[model samples]
Structures are given as C-alpha cells and as structure tokens.
Target: MEVAYRIHLTAILSVTCFLLKQGLPFRGNDESSNSLNKGNFLELLDWYSLRNEEVWKTVNQNAPGNNQLTSPKIQKELANACAMEITRVIVDDIGDNYFSLMVDEARDASIKQQMRVVL
Candidate 1:
C-alpha cells in the first residue's frame, strides 16, 4: 500500500515538474513566490489608539474633516447599507469631561465602502 502511494505521489510530482520545466508556469519560481503574497492587513490611524493627548489634538487640528462627531458624507453614503456604532474612551485629548469619542462603522449605500466617525 505504501509503495503504491509513493508511486502515485512521484508520478504526480514528475508530471508537475515536467509541465513547469516546459514553461507552463505551473510551479512558483523565486520571483513568482515573492509576488504571490498580498502582505498583512494595515492598521488604520483613525482607530489604532487614543492614547496620547498630543496625537489626538494633532489629528483634530490638522484634519478637522475627522473632528466632527460623524461623517455626513459617510452617513449619506450608507443611507441604504447596514452598519453599527462603536464608542470608545480616549485619553488622547487635552480637555475636561474626558469627553469620549463616538465612532460609527457603516458601509456605503450599496454596502461597498465602510466608514468611521469620531467626535
């Protein structure tokens, strides 16, 4: 049984290698292997951390576009899609009340693009 299994495996491998050697591109070479992986998922800046007050203030000052409690364009874009709201306490802001930010996760009206809002 084991001998038969090895024979079958060797046959498949030989066929594959033969096809690849014939320039069929069935096997991955060095460059092909390097380009196959898409890489890791990126951590977004908007929600990674609210840890430092300076960082929070910098984002608010530079991009007031993200300063509001919600993204109107986002809400409108998600007018027909399904979504949810996420709230988190941020110690990254320099102010009283320790005001927390409201973050919303919603998709475009067609459920294409998902967006977030923070206040």
Candidate 2:
C-alpha cells in the first residue's frame, strides 16, 4: 500500500511539474468526471495513466477515496513546494556572492496589480 501511494504521488508530481513548466492553467470551469474537459492537470493525469499501468492502478478508482490527493489545495501545495525548492537552489548558487535585484509592478490579464522581483 505504501509503495502504491508513493507511485501515485510520483505520478501526480510529474504531471504537476509538466504543467507548471508549460505555464498552463491547472483547473477548468467544470472538472466533474462527466465533463468533457477536466482541466489540464486531471486530463494530463488521465493521459499519463494510459501509458503507465502502475500509475493507473495506484490512482483514481484503485486508491482509497481519502488518499486520492486530487484536491485543488493539494495541487497548490505541490506548486508552492516546487517554487520554494527553486528559490532555495538559486539562493544556494548565489551564496556569499553579490547579485543584482530587480523589481517591477504591472497588471495581469485580469487587471490585477502584481509585483515582480528578480535576483
């Protein structure tokens, strides 16, 4: 059971990384099972399961309902974790070295003001 759970998480993480790298949206307007398009994340997982038997068996119907790990909150947590890891790597690489920082403010597509920082 533990191994299966790990496999399931690995699959989810892989799909999450792929979507993040592509800068794609994770959720759709309608994400029900009956919905034709269940968003990029779920759709990619389905596509991934088709190519991997272990993943297919360890997720969705095969896994326990409580351990599905398919919630939106779980997805956000994974993304945040990835971002933190990236920041850690950057900091480590710049350790004890002078680095330039840049900051800017802009509005997004939704007209929401946002700040960007680079180091």
Candidate 3:
C-alpha cells in the first residue's frame, strides 16, 4: 500500500478502536480473537496513546493548529490524486475545457476524506 494511505488507514483504525473503547457502535468483534484493526505502527501508537490521553486529545482536537505547523505535502498529494481522478471522470463525460475542479475536505476520527466536484 502507499505510505500515506497506510498512515491514513492507521488513523481510521485507531479512531475505530478508540470509539470502540468509548462505547461506540462497531460491526462486532472479540478481543480474545485478536481480530482488531490496528492499521499502522500499532505498537508505537498504542504505547504513546496509553501513556498520554492528553497528548492524543491535543493531537485530535488541535489538528488545525498541528496541521498548520506540519507539512501537508503527502496529504495534499493524495488529495490531488483524488481530485485528478474526479476531474478525469468529469472531463470524459463532459469534456475538459469548460469544467473546473472544486475540492472540499472533511474529517472526523473515523474518517478523513476529500470530496471533489466538477463545476
């Protein structure tokens, strides 16, 4: 899998598991079966998260600030790829000359995805 995608999936799984811990609805599973979805660097995230819920909270809640200080190059690369895909589909259907690519992004713990539209 792509590096950023791997990171993204890790975030998703972490959120899912976090929600599960906080009594969020999930598909269903047993801890004994060991079928949990820990996407990436599970050991490290688990260790850090266990050590500091406050830090995790800061990271989660203060994302805007963090992102401002963090390089979003990889994230933007993925977003750009998605946008190009959307643009390709629209241009195929309605030709490229008159269309514009518009992008919007949304995020929660469980999912962080970008939406693209042709206008």
Reference-based TM-score of each model: 0.23, 0.85, 0.26
Task: List, residue by residue over 5-85, the lDDT tens digit for candidate 1.
Answer: 343333333433343345333222322223553111001122321443443444334334443322334323332121121
Pick the winner on TM-score between candidates 1 and 3.
3
Clash pairs for candidate 1: 53-92
Candidate No. with top TM-score:
2
CA displacement after TM-score superposition, residue 81 of candidate 1 (Å): 32
**What TM-score would candidate 3 get against the native?**
0.26
Ranking by TM-score: 2, 3, 1
Q: Which ten residues in a row have the lowest lDDT in candidate 1?
A: 38-47
lDDT tens readout by residue for model 2, 31-57 = 998999999999999999999989999
Candidate 1 structure, TM-score to reference: 0.23
Per-residue lDDT tens digits for candidate 3, residues 61-118, read 4445434212235334544555577668877988646655677767667786645544
> Candidates' lDDT values, in order?
0.35, 0.91, 0.46
lDDT-better candidate, 1 vs 3: 3
Q: Deviation in angstroms for 111 in model 1?
A: 1.6
Worst-scoring 10-residue span by lDDT in model 2:
60-69
